[model samples]
Target: MSKIIKKIFISTIMVSTTFSLLMGAESIEISPSIDKKIFHEQYVSVTVKLNNKNISKVLIVTDKNEHYPIELTTQCDNVCSKIIKLRLGENSIRVEGYIGEELAYEVKNELYCASQAFREYKEAPIKYKERFFHTDKNEKLCAECHDMSNNEQKKVAFVDVKDSNCFVCHKAITLDRYAHAPSANWLCTSCHTGEIENKSKNIIEKSKFIAPKQIASACFSCHDKNKQSWDTKKHKHFPVEAGMCTRCHNPHSSDNKMFLRVNSSFLCLECHADKKLSQQIRGNSKCPGEQKDGCTECHNPHASDYRFLLKSPHVDKKIDNNIKGK
Candidate 1:
């Protein structure tokens, strides 16, 4: 009985020691995983997993032996990712891990940059199928459009509006779509001026594209006539009165009519959340006589002369105090 107990304790000690040795082995893993060879975008986010936690530095070595040091915020426990810019053709990258001056571990990855041809290949991963807005053609010209300087007083979204370079690559925004008037004219600064009113709630600190807190303020600048007309109406939609126009509308270009985020009925029901209306629209209700045309069949989205923002008079029904009325 004493000999059996001693043998059990010895086996447990040997197993624990072997497990610790395997866990401490140094290695590096690179991804876009070697099997998926092609990447649609020039800039690819590569994740490196380090089994040895002591590695203090990470670097990418190109096939030509050019070493680019990657800045790590901290010595990562196991994983760190960086956006690496790849050359236009077949390329090889070696992700190397180091402790101070000495190399610790390294892993190699191969990738092909074929932005245009990637869309036609159906087998490509969904992430790599669509070409990113900032592709190879526009990669180098970022400073041309963006405000690169850190001047506190003169910081704007773009460097200059006189020769707007946005439309050069973004011409597809207006192709066969109902473009917002300002977007059609390439006057992006009308909304995104990188300056907002001091008191506005949507002031994002260090924002890449500075837009107005009150989106309606930008819309009313051009649509002053509509604002003046809507202001006097007896009934107004909550979002419209509160100047939250983007709740249902897309500020940028949209394929939908009137630049709606989705079809008017679906957009209206999203906020209204009436079980009866939702069931009727979805065709799941047992009640047969349902109006499929949706909320606009009775209620106007923005403002109406009648009660409940109705397109026609609804004097037969009782008024609800919860709804806003002039």
Candidate 2:
């Protein structure tokens, strides 16, 4: 009888230990799945389906290294859900479920805030997509952030109701860079007018300056044609004449001087690569040749009165020989 009682006690202990281990081992299923590439909204609704019932707490970590606790509606039944706001660029998120003070399980997901960026190469960065505007995918919230009414005219100010404005989310774009005049002055309506009426900001894959005429209208609207040297100069850069300013200059902001797409001399070399003139220009005695500040030393970027867009009419024999490869 004593042996039988000892055997029963041991069996009960084994079953209890197994049950405890099963309860401690936790896992989760996230809705919308983890594979979703981009979320266009400033706020994303996430639903987490849990496998364990004892998970009493939840924590969320953002890409910016922000940590916050989200209250779960149901601990066991139904789905645990939370609305999360995302920052610009890539967002790496970690969702951790906890029981008491101990971490039960953790999972990670990645998302992107779709906004317009430079489209120099064949594709934009994997984390970012080239989009026309920054409106919410749902709710069509243009009025929440932008100047929808024509009363604002050229100036776009933040709406007083909910702290909504362009800079609220997109301040990173111009950080540590020289912003364009119109961009710096909150003159978004100057260029972003038309077709934005009551529409969502989901205009991805559409190039902002798709047409040369549109580009000309947006640029020359602020830069008066009468003051420009293009008309006065005999020789003109084809991009300038064609009203394709974006080919050479970034419309928003740039680290490079004069909002150039790249450093001055290298920018000139990008197009001149086909001519095999990079080496000749670099070694030429008549040229300044410093990568950062050379091309503009002798050549006028937009146009010039002299041939070869030379800054001055007096051209050197060496320069002429370098150009002709004599």
lDDT of 1: 0.60
Estimate, for each residue in 6-48, the C-alpha lDDT of model 1 and write its tens digit: 9999999988765554344246666325323665335566656
The global C-alpha lDDT for each of the candidates, from Candidate 1 onward, is 0.60, 0.60
Q: Can you write out model 2's per-residue Cα lDDT over 3-94, one digit (the tens) per residue?
A: 99999999999888655644442466565363335543345655566777777887878868888677776332635656677765567888
- Candidate 1's TM-score reads 0.46
Worst ten-residue run, lDDT, model 1? 115-124
Q: Which ten residues in a row have the lowest lDDT in candidate 2?
A: 115-124
User: What ranges in model 2 sit over 4 Å off?
Assistant: 1-151, 155-164, 194-214, 225-227, 274-286, 316-318, 321-326
The TM-scores, one per candidate, come to 0.46, 0.53
Please report the candidate that would top TM-score against the real structure. Answer: 2
